[model samples]
Target: MSAPRLRVAPSPTGDPHVGTAYMSLFNLGFVRRHGGAFVLRIEDTDRARFRADSEQQIYDTLRWLGLTWDEGPDVGGPYAPYRQSERLATYRPFVDRLLADGHAYHCWCSPERLAQMRERQRADKQPTGYDRLCLGKSEAERRALGGFADTPVVRMLIPDDVPLTFTDVIRGEVSAPRPDDQVILKADGFPTYHLAVVVDDHLMQITHVVRGEEWISSTPKHLLLYRWLGLPAPAFAHMPLLRNADKSKISKRKNPAARLTWFVEQGYLPEALLNFLGLLGYSQPDGSEIFDFAQFSADFEWSRVNTVGPVFDLDKLDWLNGHYIRELDLAEFAGRLTAFAGDPAHADVIAAAAPLVQERVATLREGLDMIGFLLVDEASFAVDEAAAAKHLGEAGQEVIAAAVLALQADGEWAHEAIEAALRGALVDGLGLKPRQAFGPVR
Candidate 1:
């Protein structure tokens, strides 16, 4: 069989979501294991919520996590225009075919009318969906009846016997709730996700569709489009959602960690973040919690995926990040610290202090904090007032005077000799405990 093709289509609507990375990891992992192409498609058809800069953030954050795609908007492939917005012309033909075949029809129902319909459905405890108000009506007939819009949106004419069950790569046979007449194309001429995704995946030859379990409900709609358009459907694997401590689905609006950029800004190593994400829904055959992407790809299988939603445990992430941080050599660690600090002038200081904090911090931000005092000039440095009050009393002043005299008298300038002299002066001569002696100086 030809190598499979897969893609992660992320909407550029807001901050690049961690869910995007989660889906990308699985998509790219499967491709890497099976020797296939992994594509990145931008689903930017939602004009109302779309942001121009968000597309670039998606590219940047994914790359930052060390995730790459064989084809994307930035890296052109046989599928040249990878973005949904750019391929508007490509979908029109499919939409026309669906309409011509009686599989879909134009709906002139206005937004307000639909809202009121949903409101009534809620009041009546009914399953809310499109009412098919303008199913067979012309624009003139619908306008005359009122509650009509000037431009009509196309809706799929879902049959009563439309299949509600489909095969999932991970979950075996899964059944979804019966769907209503879903809108396929908006009045603005932009195809909705159902139509655009079906068209793109079929054209791009995506062999597998990997996404969060939240999309399982929408699978029937996509499957219907594939069947109606006479296109082969890709294999579906709906990975479990990442949940919060309370088992609620993680969302960027509720948790900053759900934003991919939050991990970067917090100085998490990409390898660590990738490894953490991998462990969320999968485990290595060896039963290890920590493994890099290469190992993950090598051992990936749809069957091994855990369907239960995994809690977003940050303590595990921090532990993994600390492990990765400690694995770095001193020079490399210092270099990363310098880059993350975004201060070239502090390169030497950070390098000198890297050894002191490399094993002490779980993140570059923490490393910087651990050695922040060393980075500032003496003029700008100020002692913490609370610490000063606790350690700068009369007894502490006496220890400092003795430590100064001992340092001045010692000829050797090495750390060991200086430490010995201070210990002898404060710990022995002054008879103060080590903590008492070191408190003020530190």
Candidate 2:
């Protein structure tokens, strides 16, 4: 069998979503397992909500997470013009073919008329969908009848026998409700997602469609388009959606973690973040919670995917991140800490303190926080008065004095030597507990 082709298409509407990485992880994992191509298509057709910088953010965040694609807007592939907005001309031919074949028709109903139609349908307790008012009507006839727009939008004419069930690679047989005559092309000359995705996936030779389960309802519409256009449908695998602690669908509007950039900004290791996402709807064969991407790709299987939506557990992520941080060698951890601190000048200070804090922090941000005082100048440093008052009584003063004297007598500059000297003076010599001796100094 030939290698499969898969793509992760994300709309450049806002912050790159964590869903984008989640989908990409599975898509790329399958591709890696079968030696196929993983493509990144930017679905930027939603012009009203599209941000000028969002496409770049998608690239930046995905790359930050180590989810690199073989073909994308930045990296040209066999399928050039990876963005939907750039391929406007390519969709017109398919739309025209659908129209010519009696599979789709143009609707002149304006937004006001469609809204009124939906309002009437809701008032009468009917299934809300286009009423097919413009079907079989000429442009002039529709204009004469009443509400009509100058520009016409294309819609699919759903056949009575439209299949409502399809096989999902992950969920076995899945069924969706009968679809309405969905708009294939808007008056703005942009194709809707239903039309654009079908055309692009077919043309790009994508063999697998991996996305969130929320799209299950829309699968029938896409399958209809594929059948109507005489295009071979790809294997579909709808991954479970990520849910919040309350089991609500995770969204950028309500949850900051839904945004992919949040993980990067929080100083999470990309490997750890990637692994965390992998564990969301999948489990390793060895039943281990912690594993790298290479191991994940090697063991990728659609059958292993859990259909139930996984709750986004941040505490688990923190534990995994801490494990990864501790696994890093001191030199690499120090470098990462300096970079994440966003201050190149603090490299030496962070390096000097890396060993002391490497095992102490779960994230680079926390590591930096632990040594933040050392980064500031002498004048800028201020001890917490409450903390000092609590720990610096007479006994604390004695411990400090003994530590100073012992260090001054034979203090070695090395870590072990300094620790041994301080412990010997404060813990062994002064008969004070280790925490008692170190609490005030720290």
Candidate 3:
């Protein structure tokens, strides 16, 4: 078999989503392992939802996560015009061909009509979709309806009630009931996902279609389009959807974790976030969870991928990020902390205090809190209310006083001197236990 060619087509709708990163991880793994090409296509045909700058955000975030595509709108390839919006003219001839061959027909039904049709279908307990009202209308009937000024949307025909079966790389053989004829082209002259993806995948020779499980029901429609167009369909692998702790769909509106930029902004290392995503649906041969991306690509297997959805467990990710943080050399770690801090004023103090909390912080952003006590102005530094309430009683105050006297008399202003003074004053001098002695200071 030829090397698998995979593509991730993200709609330029909003801030790049973590789901986009998830799908891209799997797609990148497959293509990289097989020495194949990974393509990036922009599905911007949804004009109302499209943001002009969103496409760049998608590219930027994915690259930040180290998920690179060989060919994309930013980089031209054998299949030029990678963006669906740019390929508008390309879809017209295909739509015309489908129409001439009786594989699709024009539907002049307005939004109101379709809504009413779906409402009536719901009322009658029937499938909700286009009623194919324009299928066999005579010229006079169409003229009476609105003449050509209506600019009807094009709907592809679903031949018969046959089961559409496809072997999924991750889910094994899957079959779904053939769906109703779907709109291939909108009245605005833009092709729907079903039509655009089919054409682009076929033309780009995408050997594998790696996407979210939400698209499973729609796969049969895509399969039908490929059949009608006489184009070979790519292998399908629907990765399990990422869900919140409550088992609900992860949404940007409801969950900040759904936004990929949030992770980056939160100071999550790209490698660590990618590693977290890698383990969500796929795991290593040894069942380890901390491998880097290169190691992951080396051992990626479709058979090992899980069908059951994985939770976007932030705690687990924190633990993983901490592991990566500790693994970094001190210099690199300090450099990373500096970049994440994004404040020049804190640079020197952070550098000096880096080693103190290098072993404590999970994310670089957490460095601010871990070392804030050192760099924050004494006037502005307030004891955490919760900690103070728990530890700032009479005994805690005595412990603090004893440590201060010890440090005041100590001639050397060095690490060991400070440590010994603190221990002598608190741990050895005070009857309190180590945690008790340090509670107030901590």
Candidate 4:
């Protein structure tokens, strides 16, 4: 068999979503396993909602996770113009051909008329869709209708008697009733997602269409377009959507876990984040969760993917991150924490304190809090009131005073020497136990 070509098409509308990374992980894993080509296509057709800076954020975030693509807008490939906005001319020709062949018609219905149509449908308890009022109108008649704009939008014709059926790699054989005639091209002359995606996927030679299960309803619409255009459809695999603890679909507006940048900013290791996402709807054959990205790519299989939605548990992610944090060597761990610290003034202190708190922190951001006392000015440093109240009473002050005297006399300031001095002053010199003596000074 020939090598497959898979692509992840993300819309640059807002903050890069965790769902985008989830889909990319699976697509990249599949491509790596088969030695196939992975592509990144920017679906920036929604001009009204698009943000200019969002495109670069998507690229940066994906690369941070080490999910590199073979072809993208940044690096030109066999298929140049990876962005949909750049390929506008390519879609117009296909739309014109469909119109000329009678497979689609111009829709001249005004906004008011369409709104009233939906209102009437709601009142009559009928399915809400375009009534196809202008489906049979001619060119001259459409031009005579001065109530609307200069030109009409294009809509694909859906056969009422034809039942649509397609087998999904994850959902198995699925069937749906014939859908209403969908608008393929908007009034603004921009093709809708249904038309644009079908055209671009065929042109890009994408062998598989892997996306979230939310797109399953629109699969039939896409299938009809492939048939109308006389183009072979690619294989479809709709993965389960990520859910919150409450079982609601994950949304960036409501859930922080939905944003990819949230994890990065929170100091989550890229390897750990990717490993956690990989196990959401898929698992290893050995049922281990502490594997690296390369191991995941080697063991990834479509048959092992679960169809049920997976919950985005924050606590579970923290546990996974803690495991990865502990596995790093001392030098590498100190380097990662130092980068997160973002302060050269504390370089010597951070290198000294990192090994002391390596096992106590799950994230590098958490390390900042754990060692805050060592970095702050003496005037700014303050002990926790509750902890001081519990351990630093009048009697506790004497133990700390003795610890200070012992440390001042120590010849060496090394870790072992400091440790031995504290132990002699607190545990041996004083009759009090180690916990009791250290509690006051700690």
Name the weakest run of 10 consecutive residues (lDDT summed) in model 4: 142-151
Report the C-alpha lDDT of model 2 over 1-442, residue by residue, as the tens digit. 5899999999999999999999999999999999999999999899999999999999999998888999999999999899999999999999999999999999999899999999999999999999999999999989997878999999999999988999999999999988999999999999999999999999999999999998999999999889888889999999999999999999999999999989888889999999999999899999999888899999889999999999999999999999999999889999999999998998998899999888888888888888998998998888889988988988789888988887887555887898899998888998888889899888
Off by over 4 Å in 1: 378-413, 417-440
How far off is residue 435 in model 1, in Å?
6.8
lDDT tens digits, residue span 1-442, model 3: 7888899999999999999999898889878888999999999999999898899999999999999999999999988889999889998999999999999988877677778789999999997876777888754587586424377888888777645887888898888766888899998999999899998899888888988888888998888778878988888988899999988989999999899999988889999999999989677998887788789899788898888889999999999999999999988888888878777777787888899888989898897677778777878978788878788888778877887788789379998888878888888877668889777767
For TM-score, the strongest prediction is 1
For residue 80, what is the lDDT in candidate 3?
A: 87
Q: Which has the higher lDDT value, candidate number 2 or candidate number 4? A: 2
Q: All models: lDDT?
A: 0.92, 0.93, 0.86, 0.89
User: Can you write out model 1's per-residue Cα lDDT over 264-355, one digit (the tens) per residue?
Assistant: 89999999999999999788999998788999999888899999999999999999999999999999999999999998999998999899
TM-scores, each model vs. reference: 0.92, 0.89, 0.90, 0.88
Error of 1 at 389 (Å): 6.8
Best by lDDT: 2
Which candidate model has the greater TM-score, 1 or 2?
1
Pairs that collide, model 3: none
